[model samples]
Target: MLAYLADVFSALSELNHSLQGRELNIVTASEKLAAFKEKLVLWIKRVKRGNLVNFPCLEETVTENSTLPPTFVAKIVEHMQMLCTSFDGYFSCGELQTCNIWILNPFMQNLEDVDDDGSIKEDLIDMRHNCGIQMEFTNSQLDHFLASQREAYPALATKGLEVLVPFATTYLCEQGFSCLLHIKTKSRNRLNSEHDMRVALSTKTLRFDAIMEKKQQ
Candidate 1:
């Protein structure tokens, strides 16, 4: 479903040639999103009827027991609304013109302005207004700016860049879950200890020769 939506977003071009390389603007996105969601809702119902897909982790294979019910489908449909609400502010922050202004909302409400320590500094705040607008208004652009100007901005570069990068999916999370499954299969139900499990699951290899040379030294 995610891959399908991604393709649709990539293919759907604005009539104006000026937006040829850019992502879909809000108004265009709304129309496309509504159409996509309508089709998606119907497709989801069909999948439920077809009984092809499986729950991510569970061992259950029975269609009658595993397939999502109608109420659950309706709940899933509300996710589009939730997504739109979430993106409304973040999208505003995507533009250089509005990005800093939206970020510095005094209530600490804008996601980019939010600091966990509640000790956001004046220098960092000044950097936002001073530098954020001059840069290109894209996640990749900001990432490149930090990569190039680490000495110039220091910690503020990291702080500002962190919030701009969006989380599209749990790709790493799903990979880690699959790794856990591979490590703890039916054959090996449990490890002796958490430390043992960590050692077993780690991708690193032993450097016995290096350790021996250090010991000799």
Candidate 2:
């Protein structure tokens, strides 16, 4: 079961890499992940029925009980789906086709113990009102707006920035560590490549425009 999950995640590494460091709305990722899990269950059934089980007990477990619940899939999905969002509110944070507002409502409601400066509270109200009316809440717009008002709303701006902070998906981190291990293999260590060691390792592809420019040069 663990090995099957590894296969599923390996297939998803490219998607995880593509999304790293980008402001995300995980509604679609969650749907695709659920679909993939269903596909995996079907594959498992096919393999087991065909005598492809790696262990004898796996054959007994899968072949005997054709109607057995996919306990492994359920366990994995329980934790993974927790990290996903079902768009509980009216905002996409600039990640949707139809731009909507209310992205900051839930996050604001969650903040506690804020210092009571009348100015900061006023700024928060104004920012929320103004941004909520906009067609979208893009990361660049958020950055510029916050930068211009940092001194005016230090605490609010900090918290607002935190709300927009991006996180790497689990598969991306696993693939990165895998790459690091491969790059620093004992055979390569013998070559004393300090310059190479200084480069940050990543699995993401470069932007298409940047790659084209490099090729021209």
Cα lDDT of model 1 by residue, 19-108, tens digit: 222233333333444554455446455445643332222113334556555675455446535544554554342233333433223223
Candidate with maximal TM-score: 2
Query: What TM-score, over all chains together, does every model reach?
Result: 0.30, 0.35
Q: Please name the candidate that would achieve the greatest lDDT relative to the true structure.
A: 2
Worst 10 residues of 1 by lDDT: 13-22
The weakest ten consecutive residues by lDDT in model 2 span: 94-103
lDDT of 2: 0.48
Q: What TM-score quantifies how close candidate 1 is to the native fold?
A: 0.30
Report clash pairs, candidate 2: none
Candidate 1, superposed: residue stretches over 4 Å from native: 1-97, 100-148, 192-217
For residue 174, model 2's alpha carbon misses the true position, in angstroms, by 2.3
| Global lDDT scores for all candidate models | 0.46, 0.48
